[model samples]
Target chain A: MSSKSNDKDLGVRKIIYDKDGKPCRSCNTLQDFQFATGKISAKDIQHIKNGTEIAAASPQETILNSKAYRRVDPPGVEELGRSSWNLLHSITAKYPKSPSDEQKLEMKQFLTIFSHVYPCNWCASDFEKFIKVKAPKLNSREEFGRWMCEAHNEVNAKLKKEQFNCDFWEKRWKDGWED
Target chain B: MSSKSNDKDLGVRKIIYDKDGKPCRSCNTLQDFQFATGKISAKDIQHIKNGTEIAAASPQETILNSKAYRRVDPPGVEELGRSSWNLLHSITAKYPKSPSDEQKLEMKQFLTIFSHVYPCNWCASDFEKFIKVKAPKLNSREEFGRWMCEAHNEVNAKLKKEQFNCDFWEKRWKDGWED
Candidate 1:
């Protein structure tokens, strides 16, 4: 077996077959995805609904309730922030462009990393309480971003004079810091 | 708000906690795992390392590669096959069993599922492929279970003929049968 590489370079490859392996629902074309050389990843028949074609009657194809999901590789520690950022941006999309998608994404990214070290349920009420009291309910992405920045300050204020762990901070702050 | 029902009847609640807010790893005291309903799910405070004491470590106390690992939930209608089964089982300790003890706990219950699903690779190939080809070794749980039962013929043989969705099977079987 080859030695595992770090997050920066996870070598991956694809498997090809004569007949299209998976067909897309819309055009009945093949679904495009990658596979690791020796590893197998999950595949989805593109655009299929609940074992049926998506009719206007079915608003959403299917909502997978399980918290578990699979991808090509085990998620990299560095990738967590980015994944969380995408999640936040998606959730913020529900509310009118209030919290700019970019800022909301940042807050979710930061919290994902924070939860790693802090060991708190991201959705736990106590944590939610901390946010609700310390930060107003974020109406927009900018407001959410401001809240997170403030939370960072609060943490540093307690460590007063002692700088926050730069390495830890850097890992979470994937995109360049605004301030 | 509805009071906590006896989930024990449902085979859902396995772990128990005493606190009303959240499980505090530091004190090993009972805490509410959920805030809205003040209900806690059954959980074991797994020392990222199974045998180590959480407190001995200075900065890293909780699960290593600390992240929220939501428990694997039951599969849905669409997730009934080999790929989804392997993906679902991979997350929980009940499915895969690791080859070595030194590997991460996540590796523990996964060996079985891994062996089975490794060859299938997103359902591209099933266990029957390995059996017929007499190549590509299979030994893990996934191999034994998924490949042997569902992928092979064990599952099909065991199922009552009535359980077979003849219409579905007829539609998918050899090209001539479908036409």
Candidate 2:
């Protein structure tokens, strides 16, 4: 089954192969993967070939260097991650204030399937694990919103990013912050 | 239930109320609603208050005028839409070349719930209608990718945007365009 020629041609797998020939989608944060994918620039590929440790550069630095990147190609994994989170959080914000039993069950089912089909293989696996340990809290809008925020913080922690304060999640994601 | 103060304070609903007092999320495209929610700028509000026909401006014009927009707020619906499509298309690209029956079932279930909970209420309703008429084809990667492209085109057609050709789906999404 793994012998499909198109699988090798997919580019993402070839770009991040591990020593054992396994595709290592989780080897670096999503931002670094974007650089490796050539979504940013050929300069990054050149850096990788020269062993210049391009992955060490911050995501902001990479973006600053690639002003033309947005026009040239579709979004890489970082863009995907950010966008998916925005959608998830926005949906949670709009969740019914007092959800019915059916609503709760539907939400739980949705999160479970979302983790399964998420494009980043490693990220999906991690989310699967996270949900298994702490299933979605879908009884009410606030509960679901906080749960989503915590799930995001889990990913942020894994990526060595600062943890977002869950207390302010509604302000951050739904209501605009008060001055 | 209708008396809930927070419901009106949600801003999204209040900004786009129709004659029947329903929050008409579909009254205008998501991009226009973003201006109403202050995701773009106060300048847009000023234009609206002055009866400058701001809604008549194109999306590109709105985006070009919002350089400071990102610094102050969460993503508006348009940004969320773009990001969501990126993730969805990428996931379809990576769907198994020959999916197992279980995998196909899981993908279909995901799409159904995704349509229900997607944050853009109008978009979600439209998708629900689309999927009811033409269910997701999940038997193989090619089928799934083509189905998604067609689904997206349906949305593009509604928004009066140009339809993307599905012939180059893999190149436009999964693989980078050949130089």
Residue-level lDDT of model 1, residues B32-140, one tens digit each, is: 2221123333332233224434332112232224343122211211223333332222222122233233222323223332333221122323333434454322334
Question: Candidate 1, residues A40-90: lDDT per residue as tens digits?
Answer: 122222223224443231122222331322112222212322233332322
Tell the DockQ for candidate 1.
0.02
Range of the 10 consecutive residues with the lowest summed lDDT in candidate 1 chain A = A23-32
Leading candidate by TM-score:
2
Best by DockQ: 2
Which DockQ values do the candidates obtain, in the order shown?
0.02, 0.27
Model 2 C-alpha lDDT per residue in residues B1-179, reported as the tens digit of each score: 03234423333233544344643333333444554544444565566556676653323221223332222344555676787788789889778888999898988888898888887676788899999999999888999999999999998888677667777677667654534
Estimate candidate 1's alpha-carbon lDDT, on a 0 to 1 scale.
0.29
Q: In model 2, what lDDT does residue B3 have?
A: 28
What shift in Å separates residue A123 of candidate 1 from its native position after superposition? 31
RMSD of each: 21.3, 9.8
